[model samples]
Target: MANMSMTKTPIAEQDPKVRARNFKEVTLGYTAEQAVEEAKRCLNCKHRPCMSGCPVSVRIPEFIAQVAEGNFEEAYKIIKDTNALPAVCGRVCPQENQCEGKCVRGIKGEPVGIGRLERFCADYMADKPMNIEKPEPNGHKVAVVGAGPSSLTAAGDLAKLGYDVTVYEAFHTAGGVLMYGIPEFRLPKSIVQHEIDNLTAMGVKIMTNMVIGKVLSIDELIEMGNEAIFIGSGAGLPRFMGIEGEGLVGVYSANEYLTRINLMKAYLEDYDTPIMKSENVAVVGGGNVAMDAARSAMRLGAKKVYVVYRRSMDELPARKEEVHHAQEEGIEFLVLNNPVRIIGDENGRVCAMECVKMELGEPDASGRRRPVEIKGSEFTLEIDTAIMSIGTSPNPLIRSTTPGLSANDHGCLIVDENESTTKEGVYAGGDAVTGAATVILAMGAGKRAAAAIDKYIKSK
Candidate 1:
């Protein structure tokens, strides 16, 4: 029987005060009992709208039924049938906008804690290793660019099809954004490593520090005997406001800051990575990246961290859970404000920032209310460090080097309906095609492109 409870079981977590000062994970995963209880809440809707909401189309009811039956290992198998990174996706994917959003239980009250249960199943399997069978080699080879979620998903899928899959990552680490972009406190690197290890166990070869464009171009890969290539090189080019003092010594982009702390091991004292010890830091923007920056700044010894968003709280594009966590961790939100310029001292170091108050006006192209500047409402804020978290676009390295690969005006790769690019035998997906997006969406793109690549290769 369904739990029939309006309220959901609360997952344990670190204390806000303690977590704010440390780099440890904030939300401790659900216990086995808690996971079982949460699974019982799934109504097992005949329509399975929750599965439809998922980008990778995970069989929701089937997995939930296994969980409800106390067969977590079976549930993990069901999830793995479609999703490659359940643990990471369970933590970071915007469930509010996706699977959980279409939950039947959520129609009247709280949704079943799907993410929590998924995490439980994954963690359970991790603790007790399960035997997995490797597919026989199909004698075909495919090259995947970038070891991020998208490329990793495609690599896993192709490897399962008995193809020789190799993932090329620019960074020294395997996981691209999963290693450099996302914080360990949000999605632990160990978990990501475990997932990557599973992929490697399946005969998927991962070569780190392999910059496709510079080290080996697309032409070189084909000549090297790779059958097809899938570009999942994500958007890593950080966008910054063209304002005075932006080049100040204490300024940093969210990507650079997170990379240093997450990938470079700057958060630890033993590591030699240099990171700013800002006393008063301000992160500009309101999305999840902005929250990560603000929270990271706090852990990096910032006495005060401020989020300067141009829109109101309701207009915030970040996950509601993230925003709430930020608030609980003592992050001050200065909403309805936009930065105009950063003020610096004579030594070219940031000292303060000038901002203008904004009000909601007409809806913009993004369907969100346009923030209009409130004239004569400019003010100054005292800040030692300024971190820009506005947004990012795809890096032009591969696109610029690869011939016949067309990109849009914004530098995003243009692909056909089959995720095939202008160049034959090549396909692109994820943030490389669409700007910064969710991990699930990127994985979906990879899955689609993998099918297209397989079909394209067979036709040859």
Candidate 2:
């Protein structure tokens, strides 16, 4: 640890009870002083195993050195060289499992705060003028489907290469799941919009309200002057546990429920859109999305919010910080319980949900212990609302229209190491390729696909 300065740990965030009542960002960003101090904790190892966990491979040590020296511009340059969306990554990336996971300092003490430093540098440069390089025009046009993280990264990279990229987003706004799927408390809409604006500044054309497979097919993209097409349309289909009373009123897929509130701004007092209400709400799942939905429901004025999961607290898959915040906001946790049926009232409105106690069985193929219900341990609890956050797969629209676009049994599009689809000049990646995954993994897919598209266009 020679020549390395120790950094102070970040202080605890604001009380969740007070913060959850509003739409403000949950984790306040690090101050300039705090960021620089945290930067010093890096040992600047020669091998730099931390970079190995990074998807896009930002120069971890170099950036830390710059921040340690108080050279903010140099630090940002090191990050922006590869990562196109640092601001978003800083806030949402799972550093604990990724970059920080491989840190040498983590052998004994805490690891260097690479995620926080990346976020700080990105935000610092965001206020100043953008200085990203614009590659010489390649004179080829590419059609990018979806505006989620994958497509955003691909489009940004393709735009820099001067490919005349146009992102087609089905939603009114440019961000796909980022705009609708994620709640404002986790990722602020303004920050996402600002990042999109940066891409536009780089000459990336974005077309909103344009559903690709429906409005135009894969064939149309090539026919309409686009030499190559990149499908990054993320998993839009929500999975529901097919049980009784699923059709009951007030039951919602987490996607539909969050979109109704986040993208549509249904919670705004003067907003035109409206959302259903209930005194007690139940969100089924143990992931971060479940936490987001339950917390959001509480903000919408629900008297009580409950997280229903089949696993124990230790096995819950949500981020530790998110779990801590949810508890602070007064959200209740119903662990080791599985929903059997969603019961409804005489009017077909959701009134209660039947649950069964579960015991952890042997590990399943997915590696997590499977939940086996204890027979005769069923119980019913009255509830006004139920939200399902199991998971989602890519929509069938693209696969339906684009012949020869190979997909597996799960309906997720199949792509190779380079992200080229079965089609000659088409490439697909992100959640569309792998099922729902982290933002960084999807971003890596996008970066890889951009090169594939560029090479295909050159060959043509």
Candidate 3:
């Protein structure tokens, strides 16, 4: 029976001005007492629809029941059986679009705060001493490219099944997008490092600064004694609005901006090399990445920040919670507007931007109402920096060098449902296959590919 008197507890966050000036965790997590109360909101339903909503099918009701009884360790055990990176998932995942969104309680009142409870359980588990049992050597080696969520999931799973796994990453460190693409405030790098450490402790070999196509092609991997290959290399190329003056000094692609700050540690001035610093900045797009970039820019000391999206507020693709957080942190939302061009000053630095008003029209191919430009509604806004968060694509380095690997017209690799490429034993997934997509979805693709590669190697 549900506690009719108790509703879900809303998680609190940091204050606007203080958070804007520094890079620190914004959302304070639920305490043990609050977590138990939140867990009690679960009806402990029989059908378990929430489980179906999760890509990894976490045991939602079981975990909730355990938490409701103050059995945090038991709850963690159930979630970890299905997910390798529960803590990370609990924080950044779009539970509204996934697990929590399907809660039966949500039909009447607020959904059981599944994400918060999940975080609680996972965090509790992280605090405890872990004695994970490692699988004995299966006498075969598998190579995984890219150490993002996808590669990490595949590598962890493969290692558990006793296959020797070596993960090759392009960056100086592992946890590709998690460490660099996501801000430290949303998901602390320590949590990401902890997850990677779990894999490494399980005997998964990680080689950093090893770009597969550049360091060694896919064919060479097979020749070098790899039984099978999983290319979880995510989409790394940034897209722009194709507006003029994008090459101006103060203009940055969200990819570069995030990479410079998150990966290079530009926030810790003495640790990282120099990167461009701005005062007034505008970020173009509505996705979570755009919000992340815009918020990060403010923390990097920008006086004012703007989120410029072509569509209306209802059409924003970022998680509702994140969008709300951005607004709460004082990020200006300039909806129903589209940038036409970036204006530059005499020194070739970004000075301002020219934009036009847009109106919602009939639904387009993506099912969202298309935005139409309004004639004579053009205007210009002054700003020191502009960042394009429009979208991203697969990098062409591997596709161009790896023979027999066919990519779609957009250069995203075409793979089977099992994530097998045209090239034998060379499996690919994540954004590298689907272009820009949700992290969980990319991880789902990686999980499927890992299973397929496991089967392929065993068959041989």
lDDT of each: 0.92, 0.88, 0.90
Work out the TM-score per prediction. Answer: 0.99, 0.96, 0.98
Off by over 4 Å in 3: none
lDDT of 1: 0.92
Q: Give the top-scoring candidate (lDDT).
A: 1
Model 3 scores a TM of 0.98
Error of 2 at 327 (Å): 1.6
Q: Considering every candidate listed, which one attains the maximal TM-score?
A: 1
Question: The CA-based lDDT of model 3 is what?
Answer: 0.90
lDDT of 3 by residue, 1-460 (tens): 4565446787777887788788888888898888887888888888999988998888899999999899999999998887888899999899998998898888888889999999888888786789878899999899999999999999988999999999999999999889999999898999999999989999999999999899999889999899999998888899987879999999989999998889989999688557768888999999989999999998888878999999999989998888988988889999999999999999999999999999999999999899999999999989999999999999999989999999999989989889999999999988899998877887788788889988999998
TM-score of 1: 0.99
Output candidate 2 Cα RMSD: 1.7
Better of 1 and 2 by lDDT: 1
Candidate 1 stretches greater than 4 Å from native: none
For every model shown, the clashing-pair count is 0, 0, 0
TM-score of 2: 0.96
lDDT of 1 by residue, 120-169 (tens): 88888987865767889989999999999999999999999999998999
After the best TM-score superposition of candidate 2, give how far the Cα of residue 42 lies from its true spot, in angstroms.
1.0
